[model samples]
Target: MRILVVEDEEAIAEGLKFNFEQEGYEVVVATDGHEALAAVSQTDAEEFALIVLDLMLPGLSGYEVLRELRQKQVMTPVLVLSARTLSEDKILAFDLGGDQYMTKPFALREILSRVKSLIHRHQSIRLSTPAAPADPAPAAEQSSSTQGSSPGRFQFGRVIVNFQTFQVSVGERVHSLTTLELELLKYFIEHQGEVLSRTRILNHVWDEHAEVTTRTIDNFVLRLRKLIEPDPSKPVHILSVRGTGYRFLPFPSSQDVTDEEFAE
Candidate 1:
């Protein structure tokens, strides 16, 4: 597998490249956002399987580069690495089409795991989609694992999800989400139209004995809001339960919502 490492810090970039190369991956390094964009465009077309992007950069910011790439329809999966661990910052990155975000001072092993998981998940999603008439069924069948999964697409206000593949598409850009995001989205899809409290979501999604704080849930919800909400600030699909929690209003009709208001 080939990967792109985009970071302004020289030591970090070199260390990552060395580690990835040792893992049998063809590694490419870029010092800033402009160089990162050029490296992606110039590399074997769409061959760079993953990108490790740092938020702060010299010439162009990582956010700008990511937005530009998505605007140009480059579907390469990106894992953002930033010193900013705030919820709002993470939300903005996701809104701009990032697949995952990690804070600075992070362990190299964790980064490697995330990179591998993202690439594997993306490959699975692409393979699970229905192929064109020219393609053979046997090859497609061989690509996906028929494990614990369900059929039928998950629908909620212009969003469609394939549970088996863990694929989600909003507007036209298909995002390759991390494992945690996929699980959370699946839970919402399963219980659409019902208000689910943070406590309940925590127990179900993060395992029963999880000691994780509520802020984690909030961050995850913020990221989800960026994806499914038409106007995330004034949500429509995923509605706030008001001093309580949240509700996933699935496939709400025009009658359920006003032209300017969120659905009932």
Candidate 2:
């Protein structure tokens, strides 16, 4: 697999390239965020398996690089390796769609392990190429299970999501969702019409040991709202319940049209 190493420090970048190449990975070293972005956008450039990004860069900061990548709907898994150890830094990275994170002055072994894990997880989901959106289906009537395996396709309001392919459509717009985004949305769909606490979502979807705070959940919800809600400022499908957690209402009201009626 090919990996992009975006680090300005010469020694560190060379060391990582050497180690990753030894481990059977084809590594491309980009000394700054601009180079990394160029590598990704250039048509002849090869598709990368993963990216090891650094926050400090010459022309563009790693944060800007990651944000632009996600904004363009590039779902390549990114592992942030930065010196910023603050919780807020990590939170912003995740909010901007980073897949994994690690601090600098890092050990080579752990980096290799995380890179392998991220690549494996991303491939498991296939970061699929866009296909024709499937015919919209009625929302599931059964309760979404918190255990066992995740279900496949789900439609609510005008949104149609294929959990298997990571393809989603809202009205006429389609989106490529990150793995975490897909997981969180699936959890909401499974428990449709039920109020889910931020804590419970963190535990079930993020795992109990995840270091993220409830604010991360709020940010993710906001991102999801932009995709599925008609007016994010006045959201109807995913509702906020005062001081309690949020709720997912598949059919928020009587006047709303079924997805089938709006099919093209």
Candidate 3:
């Protein structure tokens, strides 16, 4: 397995590289976010098994790097190591598609364990399912009858999602979804109408070794609502269960009303 460690701190970066190398895994170090992005671009983007990312960097902030990577649909699992312990910071990291996060003074053994677990889980998922094509046929070019008609595609209200391509469309406007957003949407569709607790979501969507807070889950839910809900202020699809968690209603009551009601 190969790992990329992106950190501006020389001592910390070297220590991680050394420890990871000792475990028989190849390690590459990048002192800044730009260098890290450059390295990923130069190599096979999918070749690296894991990435150790730091939030504070010289060239680009970790948030920017993470956002760009996800924008480009790079699915490499990222494990964030940062001194910032604020819930907001952690939430932002997860929202930007980070797979795991650890505080600055984290134990080396724990990091190693998390890395191994992430790699194993990722490989298992890949083996179980066909990897998405590097560049799928554009959704617009597909036959109208086949659009959102296959098992891999789904439609709700005016929104259409192509799971295989990670493409989402609202009405006629197409949008690119982050990896995490796509995963969460898929989970919701699979468990439609079931109330999902924050803990349940965190366990299912994030790395098992990740130290995630429920607040992070809330943030993600809010973002999803913005994308899928017709009126985010009065959400009818992703309904909060008061003290419980949230429920996903694929066909909300508002959309199910008769034509007479709509005419009224």
Q: Pick the candidate with the highest lDDT.
A: 3
What lDDT, from 0 to 1, does candidate 3 have? 0.76
Q: How many angstroms is residue 234 displaced in model 1 relative to the true structure, after the best TM-score fit?
A: 7.4
Which of 2 and 3 is the better model by lDDT?
A: 3
Name the runs in model 3 displaced over 4 angstroms: 21-25, 71-75, 120-179, 255-264
| Better candidate number, 1 or 3, judged by TM-score | 3
Q: Candidate 1: where are CA atoms >4 Å away? A: 43-46, 84-88, 125-184, 193-195, 199-237, 251-264
Model 2, 114-147: lDDT tens digits are 7887777667544332222222233364233311
* Stretch of 10 with least lDDT, candidate 3: 126-135
On residues 87-167, what C-alpha lDDT tens digit does candidate 3 reach at each position?
Answer: 889988988878778999889889999888777766554322222212234566545464333455776557777765566
For model 1, residues 158-178, the per-residue Cα lDDT tens digits are 566664545567768575444
Number of backbone collisions per candidate, in order?
Answer: 0, 1, 0
Q: What is the lDDT of candidate 1?
A: 0.70
Q: Name model 2 segments beyond 4 Å from true.
A: 43-46, 107-109, 126-152, 193-195, 207-211, 241-244, 253-264
- lDDT of model number 2: 0.75
Task: Give candidate 1's root-mean-square deviation (CA, Å).
Answer: 9.0
TM-score versus the correct structure, for each prediction: 0.63, 0.74, 0.74
